[model samples]
Target: MISTVPHNVRGVAASCPQCTSSLGRIWHPDMRIPRGWALAAGLFYLLALAGPFVQISIFGRLQRADIATGPLQLTVQGFDLVGFLVLAVTIIFPGIKLGIVLLTLFGIRLEHQPTRFLKAIFRWYPLIGPWAMVDVYLLGFLVAYTRLTAMATVHLDLSLFALVGLMISMAALDGSLDTGAIWDALDTGPAPRPIDADHRGGHLIGCHCCFLINRAEPGMACTRCDTVLRDRKPDSIVRSWAFVIAAMALYIPANLYPVMLITQLARTTPFTIMGGIVELFAAGLWPLGLLVLLASIAIPLVKLLSMACMLIEAQRPSGRHLLGLTRTYRFVAFIGRWSMIDVFMVSILVALVRFGQFANVQASTGAACFAGVVVITMFAVESFDPRLMWDGAREAAPETPPDPTLIAEPA
Candidate 1:
């Protein structure tokens, strides 16, 4: 028997404490607030893209960098993949993300509900949201800023200020926007299949995108969002293991080789990931140094080890501390992308510090390797279904017998 719960205008279902499966949010969704923030973000984003991001004066030669300069610089220096990744995350993806939100909100305002086109576009918002990394890019800019000022006379450009505004507006947009509410507003479809009175129990699948709970078979699409309803992610174990292994292999080269080559006065010096961190500390920027150390080095290693442990536990199915493990998985997923900080920093440096033989920064093999590690670990986290751990624990647990004392006697 299938029963679709009516969309609660207030909010979605509360999270399941036992499994850490979130069916809805605690706070109410406010559309008006987020729309304003989105508009602000859009304005800021446009300003950010329109002007020079930063400028450096080295030996009286002026070099100004635009938002696209970093990626182009990296590509010119032969790190095409890294450059593409930077361009996508910083320029392409962020714009796409804002466009999606602004378009959806605009559609909602016009139609007073979601259209078919809006539904299709909104589906990607959650997936693309994480990769639109302006905030993280700002932090990377901070680290890069320290290095730039140390080497030459640096000037913060209009684009830099605009990027700061964009970052803040994006952050605000994220916090105020209730995606569940948006989904609820979009669900103008037919009523769901009625429940069977005789049937009492069935597995409920929650839409990973919209968090819409559906009482349906695994292959069926979600009633609310039309996303495929899977009881669990397909090949969750194997895919996660593959990514983890790949990341683990790349981690070695990522740390061993120099991430960038610093050339000054015709002399080039290679700086490994650790060497960069040490340099930051030596420059008395301990806080920024610590931030980089944790993001670039510690976070990646922790994610790798934590994922390995979780995968092993999922395979074994220990019912112990499942909640803690689930929370840990969430944490791992959240922080996985921050490892890109160093990569962003490198791209910025490579773009701004181009003074021929006087000063130049070139991304090397290790930067690419470390970037691979960060991206692969992120994939590993995404592919590994946390629900699998809970499922394993449930399967391993002993079944409880029903008590006969409560049984009713028939005459």
Candidate 2:
């Protein structure tokens, strides 16, 4: 059942009881404007993708690329997985997210009751929102722009400006979306029966996709959405461990090998992750250099270490710093995808800079490995259950007794 509590005098927090996932905040005076922002973002997205994003000139040779160029070039160059990933995050997912937001907001205005399909589409907004990654892609473009400037004359195009607008509009749209208020607008049907507290030791499951609370049962489909409900993510610890191990193993090659090989006038230069950062620094682009350092080098290492620490802590009976660990898990989950910045950068460079040996960018062995690290770590974060970290603390005995000195004297 939906529960609302005062977060402050100006706003309140709404959350689902079963999984305790927050629905959204209800603000006093309700200043949200999602529809307008969503429509603006959708328009900006179209402008971003419609024409050349950036133009490059090397030795009087001109080359221009749009948003699709990167993914198409990656696929042509046999990095199909990376290509599709770029397409999904940079183009497809963002487009779909904006479309859904616009549609849902418009539907709410036009109809008295939103259909189940519309609700389902709206439900996917939060789940897919993070993966949109336009902000990350723009950062990738900045790195790509810096690298391009060193080797060639690069000029930002109209689409590049449009892309920036799209990113801003998307951020605004997300900030304005009040899921609880939207759900309330759509709540025309009978309220769902709350799961019986006594059922199966009071265990209840919340649909991961829809956040619908229901009694915990094996292989049971969610009544709201058909997603299978589980008390905890199935084999979360083991699967997360497996993904972490694989990511850790791949991390070595990801940094060691050249992520991108540049062929300029038949002089082949391979740029490893660190080598690229050092070059950026040598070029006096310290900010971009530090960005690559953090996204490509530091983020993967931090994610691996943090996941290992959380796993080890969760396995132990002592749940010291449970809240801290949960926060850490959330951070890891949120930041893991930003590591894809380098991968996306590589894709764009590989697509745009090919001038038949005068200047060419090609994906190297490390590109695939680094992509693997990012993808695997993302999966690792998804598979881990933060609740497991609290399980051990639940079983722990009370370590301290009530203070007798503070007790009031019997009168």
Candidate 3:
């Protein structure tokens, strides 16, 4: 019994961002991605493959970029660490993931039966899908590098074009692929089973500590949490509080340390993530400033509070706004990763802006851990299933005649 959002709010009239449509195509059992996107992706990939993505003329001799050499340049520039991770997250993973997605799409293209490889790819889709961050990375990088490019002469190369292709392919794959629709295409089964009713009346069935849902019975052996059925709220609250404390500890270092460092011409300028937002604000770019603050600072803090609120709600289900708060919690968690803009800016700066003698910029040490923090909190958020908010409603689904004996139980 998931608390259904009002139909009015549930659908946002999701349209193609480029071409505004009041009504976006309904994602359905038989839906396939539009063909225009595939053509665009193919063209972009070919364009990216054409020639030197980057060109460097040192003392009159010129060098070019290929898939391998793009990262090699970063390695030589003392930004080997950031480059390696980008290689994995942006380049390698998007290629593999989109390849898998395109493979599935081609099955539809040819109207041929998909092979076992297609099935394996479909299964891996959930994990692979979220990692396609190259475009996001590209955006962040370009923003930061714009300031860097004014100081140097940098040339584009074959790998740069390939990177662009990678971005397009990823976008096309995302636009075309739909999980529910894909499952239908592959004959995958229905969504997971809903949680059973909470006999005790409180909506929460699972412990935050161990994800153990069913309440402990008289002699039932608990496989994960060995708690002896005393009070669910007390145990869960304590463990969740501990995690909150750990996140708090990490938050301090994540902010204080330079989130990214811009070094050029033997000079290093450190910009904490907060510092970057401050720069935006000082420049009077209010909208971008607001966007950054929300993404980087406000949202993460709100999410932390939302997680804390879950503990609060579990302990005292008396709150009237639990349903809305739970939804808000999920939304905050959903948007939390976009805070990686600062890190992405660092990558773009490193990749696009190359000035050997006068100036150059590279990401600092803290960016990785900060990325780790975002990812860690992301996993934590995912592990927490919001559907539990309505677990108690399962029993409430079929409204019964009021019984004088049954009083409304406190959450």
The TM-scores, one per candidate, come to: 0.91, 0.87, 0.65
Q: Write the per-residue lDDT of candidate 2 for residues 146-264, one digit (tens) a residue.
A: 88888899888999999999999999877777665676566565676644333334446767766556655757987665667877788988999999999999999999999888999
Sorting all predicted structures by TM-score, with the top scorer first, yields 1, 2, 3
Model 2 bad stretches (over 4 Å): 1-9, 12-24, 28-32, 112-114, 192-227, 398-411
Model 2 vs. true fold: TM: 0.87
How much is 234 displaced in model 3, in angstroms? 19
Span of ten consecutive residues with least summed lDDT in model 3: 402-411
lDDT at 42, model 2? 89
lDDT of 3 by residue, 1-411 (tens): 111111233223343221121222233422345344544565565565465555544345444444344355556656676567566765566666656666776675555665445665655666665665666665554455445444545575555656666677666656555554454455433432444333344433433322244444533433333333322233344555665666666766777788665656668788887888788778776676777677667766777778877766655455356557666865866586676666666665555445554455556666755665666566556555444433333333534423212111111
Give the per-residue lDDT digits (tens) of candidate 1, residues 11-58: 345444345344445355668899999999999999999989889898
lDDT of each: 0.85, 0.80, 0.55
Query: CA lDDT of 222 in candidate 1?
Result: 84
Candidate 3 residue spans exceeding 4 A from truth:
2-84, 108-117, 154-178, 188-246, 281-288, 352-357, 392-411
Instruction: Candidate 1: count the clashes.
Output: 0
